[model samples]
Target: MNKLIEREKITFHKVKPDPSSLEFGKYFTDYMFVMDYEEGMGWYHPRIAPYAPLTLDPSASVFHYGQAVFEGLKAYRTEDGRVLLFRPDQNIKRLNRSCERMSMPPLDEVLVLEALTQLVELEKDWVPKEKGTSLYIRPFVIATEPSLGVKASKSYTFMIVLSPVGSYYGDDQLKPVRIYVEDEYVRAVNGGVGNAKTSGNYAASLQAQRKANDLGYDQVLWLDAIEKKYVEEVGSMNIFFVINGEAVTPALSGSILSGITRASAIELIRSWGIPVREERISIDEIYTASARGELTEVFGTGTAAVVTPVGELNIHGKTVIVGDGQIGGISKKLYESITDIQLGKVKGPVNWTVEV
Candidate 1:
């Protein structure tokens, strides 16, 4: 087992925030895991230290060239008094893939998982016990070399922090969100860093998100970068459409993120005898399906929100309401199932949750 040098914090937050009032990522736990890497020295100094501000040089490569990657997962406090992580290894694997895409060194999978498990165990009290509340885990790596250059940095820092969070949709009951489809702005192309979970990819999405907000929508559903015709994903989660009584989602065409929740949803739906198709879906096709009364449901899947029902979509100035603008059967089932599995309300797949 890879062991992290544990350093107890001299001070802890005097009062824990009310779990019911937890806006997403607003309150952090007392401790965090950190490690460093150099070109020659490799990754070293693995430790669990007090949560504090990071001091980075003004000219760090990550500050200029954006050589960084991140991963998000959650630890749940089950009703049975056990802590569980949902597919944390998948997050580490995706992190390595993002690092490879961003010209950064890959992390040791075993060590990273150990660090996550240990950190979550040590800070188990921070995992909210309230229903629909959990400890959000953010694991990120950044270029830390102190120099101004357009190339990859010679050194890096990896960290894992925990934040107690409530519902992603601002409430335990997820209302269908209005999504704005951006025809003018595209997020990522087939041959871009869009597939990677890097910082700049999100940084480039602020404009589209702002547009969505200004348009009275809750989220932005982005299109392909080059053709701008095919559906890619939503700003935060992977988009899916229940068309013609079947599940349909945009295929991973080198641009769409392969979300852990998205994959699990597909598998879970299929297990329940629902047919899921991962193929190229177009905005026009979605509107056409809606017109034909075939588009029964629309939802987004991610780590934060196990399921986000999409009620309305504004496509190039035209508004299309999805199936009476209410949460569909599939979306509701997915949310309850995933949450149940995470919180040990019911048994999930054999390998889905890792007990801590």
Candidate 2:
């Protein structure tokens, strides 16, 4: 692992907000970890410094061609004062995958993990202890070479920032959300960068999301690009449904993100002897199942919300209610199980929670 150099000047401050009133990504800690990359020298000069705005050239490649990637995870403060991270290594691996897809230099996983641990430890006091609250970590890489070309840049910057956040949806009740099924403006297609956690994919999704919001829906349910019939994912999470006592999600067909939370939920559900299947699920089949009373529950999984129950889905102008328009038993169970494991309330699989 590359040794991280510590800056001599230290800035100590605190942002102790009422945990119950915390908003996602609104506030930041006092310090940030950063590293740089060059074409021939590779990554160098890793350090943790006071949080500040970056000075980049107007012609930076990231500003023009949008060569960037990011990853999100959380750190929880256990009741006994232990700072625990949930599946951080998996997030790092996915970040590397995103780097490769975006043509950016891959990060040294061990060194990055070491840097993350050091930064989080230094700012451990910023971790919130209230229920449904934790420290959100955002790591991102952006191409920095100043050029107007359409090719990948020779310079880049990687940085990690932290925020003490409450629930992503701002609801202690874990209320079910209404989703609008989008049949137009496809999010991504097969053989594209859909699976990569890059900025462009999200930028391309803003229009549809705005439309959903304007229509009084909480999120948009995306469909496959070609047929536009099969379900792909929700606006910011992976979608799952319980039909006929079986748990099912759309398989990763090179066009959907393989979410860490989604994988963990699948594992936890399967461990309970419940049937789980990953396959292409069409929207027509879901509507038919709802009509026949076979669609019992609908939920989404991601690092942000963990598990979001889908109470209603609007297809074009038609609306279908899911599981009596409330949180299903399976949704509640999965949410509780994952949150418990994350907060260190329950012992999870070995190495699932890493100490800061």
Candidate 3:
């Protein structure tokens, strides 16, 4: 669409690794898409070049001020030899929203989508056909202007790279995980960049995540910055609860990432004639519900894991087992349903999958 992304000749190619042995985000494809933005020249010079390292100035704004944003989505190779992308348009739209929030130049959604499709098509051979493997696409923008001032940079670099990844879970089995309820550290505030997929928000989460890991937990469950009582999100996914037969998740209170998978899960569950509500759910309420044996299940949703069952939640020093400390029926159903749609095994909602 944008002048047919210029491709550099590939002199050599990397050998494909064993899909079962693949680790998440460890192996990259042969090519990548890149574009640049200037203060007055706008975004230009879109190209598809050989995957290589980037050279940036020492004082680049991104390194100094951390004005960067990124998005993640996967490309799947179906059994029929078709390449499918799940809701790529939504991912591109969210990328632009993150750009706007970080004071970076907004990309043309149509152009971005076209570039992504082209890149994935060029690297179609790298898309794993294994049962739990897919191509992980990372599209990001970084402020490139070499300056130290605490302000937005005048230039930026937008790029997309693809990695063939195995299943996000370490084990082949989809086992439930233990989560540490984080009250001492805050991931974001009402006026912060929590809603945006920026680097700082994640960097700020490392301390709590490390503490959780030290305490033998798989992930940290964050709470609201203001009240420090309401549940926000898990380490990298949106948290959900099935209390008294109703699906519940924290409302988007300007401090929570509006996850696409979270929204899709809600829609799919509601389509089954079940009730799903987006509202404030405090930690105390969850504990109380578990105490009363009313909390049936707890799960998390994200592009990485798709659906992760929360077997145990450690609030402060008290731990509560959820649904026999095993993967709930709802969690397994949602995981299978979403994976089915992604792999083209079953038809999903209209326009949910875009063929590459």
Candidate 4:
């Protein structure tokens, strides 16, 4: 059966006219893409219309059971006035990974790509061309079935929304920031849904992050669930460390998110002859490297921030500092190359940029 779509024009909240003044995820674009799914009928009701409120029953399964998944990406405008999407296929694949863990139906890749492309085109005016700014795209799925049962819902809703966002880190280049070690809580456990981009994973990390922030740290560095010693991630981003002139990061232990930006950085850096290794890294190793003056750099990668430098790491009542509290040589190069590809300053891998 064909999907049914109905369009509606709604009023948008007026804001400051300039995109440069906009904060991250504050101002939204004018339109959105929505669709609904049912058990027997499958997904239908695709629509591209004005952004508005979604009416849901108080007992909706998503409200109670927390069966929700989301993906974060961006639509960037290049120097030549052409809008493009950076690695959207990776986002679609990751979204499906989240759906499987959350017990939601897997979305069709082609359909999703089309929906996103059309939505980006609809909001092309919202894509900021200010070098570090772009239109942030959020695609999410929720269990909308009005039942309190603990099982997966028979009905769901999928939506894509856009927000014109500015630079995430700040105006200046990324400075090595501080992070607090989390010993009391674990972000993910073995054989759990930690690798999935689900809401619960993020929700579990909030308290630890709050404590880190209170300690004047920029983020929380999570550890393994059992030992609480193996360095896992830095909140929403994947982590990397430099030791002995080689780039190393924790292996995917099924408890850490495989960020798209993380993969891109690995590829870009390795192409430049940097030795990038994925292995299990422990807190002891990080501190020891810093103590020996062998730790070259530490950074986190994600969609929002792109790449962030970690200058000081606080763990188990000890403070470890890396390289004069400044961005390392490799970190700077990776940031520049990735931004160049994203902003269309340099040539990219084949089909890396999807023109809208």
Candidate 5:
């Protein structure tokens, strides 16, 4: 029987890179998935083809109006040769939600799921079996219509590309990182497209990120736009602080992203009898907790970095060290548990991992 998604394999596969020395998003796989959408025609022509460059018109809306959204998820290769995807449905649904926020047409969840499975299945060999490596799948949508007007584009292109990669923090670079608290530049406001996984949100953050780098910090910890005091996110990931045996994370305000890994960590921490609270958190409060010796651990959760511990914080001119500049117990446990669940060593929540 013919599958719903069309497939076209490449004539010759490129020489695979060394899996042990893979760079993040540096190397791409042999195949890619693509689909198109029009105002009246909806989405059609779902197909998988050989990896190639895209040709777009000069006045594409994505280049002008910036109507682009993307989602990131990984495919893990089990020790027994099976492949698994962690919370892919959540990423797909979040992609649609991002599309809605960006004035783009929604994607069919069923079609996308099918296409992802088929594409990953075909490129199973590209899934690295390294200890801390996996296949990074990037599904993105861009406005392709060549229009100069500042309006929503009539046509859009959705594409999924696969990259076999190592850790986002580099090879064997899973230790704690220094974060600089940013207050001068803001990432997003409440009414802005902050909650959406759009490209502009990231582009707007580059300035602060660069500032943090110049200040000798690994990443920037963005505060709320309005007050510039409340904690928002640390670099591109959601942040968590352990205070007096409680896991405190910034609430899912309109500006903060609802990270799937953050949610899973919260649930797992709660299951371990640790209280997890999602509310508006302030950097000042964190500093106070640290001064009082209540701050236990600080970490970040996201798709790329997974779970990253923060060892030191640069708050204005004061320097704050987190738990003796080392990975905390909670951070270690969450990282191990999540990776185990992803690799099929232990079962997680129902429907968490979709085997491809």
Candidate 6:
């Protein structure tokens, strides 16, 4: 443990449930975990208390500077009635990486794990029983020092909140979504905080997503900021394509978040006897492959939706349908395997799931 938590701070709130109309991230659990840090004084007084509003001064650095980072992961209830977290260590490591980029202090990984485990234990009933539903755990850090200077804040707060989220899509799995390739607006850039899970990265993408939706597209597929031809990612998920019997994705390239699900999928593909490559993939290559009938599938991978297939991609006034306008062979198998492992139907590599 980082430091023993103050048991007195623990509190719970009871509420009625409405299953008919559950929206993602709308409701939260009764209790949350919090820890504070100051300039010379180190982190102190870890507490698990009732979820409530945070009061910050009008001139807080975060208000003006936007120094905030967050991570999202899920805890599932196995068929045998046990709670488990999938690859939690990876999330903490990613959190530390984001902290470094945002100039926020990093907590001990062991401490974070312990704190999160305790939080889940306190709110075990909140973990949904439905197969496709689970407790969405969000751990975030924000600068809290009261100053208007354009610099990192000296004081900070780390908190964890839980949300019971169902499938991001409705009743049936989503139809293959149409994505718009935007060359006018960019999401991230090289030598920037693109690789970090910072709030600004997502806030920057919202406007483009709104524009795409207005244009009858499901989401925006952002391109490289410099050349605007290299494919980066789709919405918040990592993008993948199957071409010429191979699975290909754009390399990390210092400008994209390396998703945990993305890394897992690549390893799973390798085990399935498919070659996976991470290299620069230009939009021209995608168009060329589709035109030559070599493009088989396209999909996006993330924790929220797990895996979603993309049927149509619109690039610069040209619309291309992938593989007869339906999900491809590899896409179906990958989805089944990954979902099976998450729900405990199939065995996976060691350390993939941690018992709750």
Report backbone clashes per prediction.
0, 0, 0, 0, 0, 0
lDDT of 5 by residue, 124-195 (tens): 999999888999999999999998999999999999999998888875455999999998999888988989
- Per-residue lDDT tens digits of candidate 4, residues 1-356? 12444566666644534876877787777889999999999998888878878999999999899999999999889999988899999999999989998899999888899889988987788888886888999999999999987899999999999998888876854967898989998899978989988888888888989989888998999999999889999987899999999999988989889989999988988899889999999999988888899998999999998899988989897988878888999988888888888887887898788889
Candidate number with greatest lDDT: 3
Better of 1 and 6 by TM-score: 1
lDDT by residue for model 6 over 160-232, one digit each (tens)?
Answer: 9998888777565545888999999999999999999999999999999999999999989999999999999
Q: Write the per-residue lDDT of candidate 2 for residues 122-237, one digit (tens) a residue.
A: 88999999878899999999999999988999999999999999988886447999999999889999989999999999999999999999999999999999999999999899
lDDT of 1 by residue, 314-343 (tens): 998999999799999999999999999999
lDDT (Cα, tens digit) per residue for candidate 3, span 119-168: 99999999999888899999999999998989999999999999999889
Worst 10 residues of 2 by lDDT: 1-10
Q: Which sections of candidate 2 miss by over 4 Å? A: 1-3, 12-14
| 10 residues in a row with least lDDT, candidate 4 | 1-10
| Better structure of 1 and 5 per TM-score | 5
Error of 4 at 123 (Å): 0.6
In model 3, the runs with Cα more than 4 Å from the true position are none
Per lDDT, what order, best first? Answer: 3, 2, 5, 1, 4, 6
Q: Candidate 4, TM-score vs. the true structure?
A: 0.96
**Looking at model 1, which ten-residue stretch has the lowest summed lDDT?**
1-10
TM-score of 6: 0.96
For model 4, the stretches where C-alpha displacement exceeds 4 angstroms are 1-17
TM-scores vs. true structure, each candidate: 0.97, 0.98, 0.99, 0.96, 0.99, 0.96
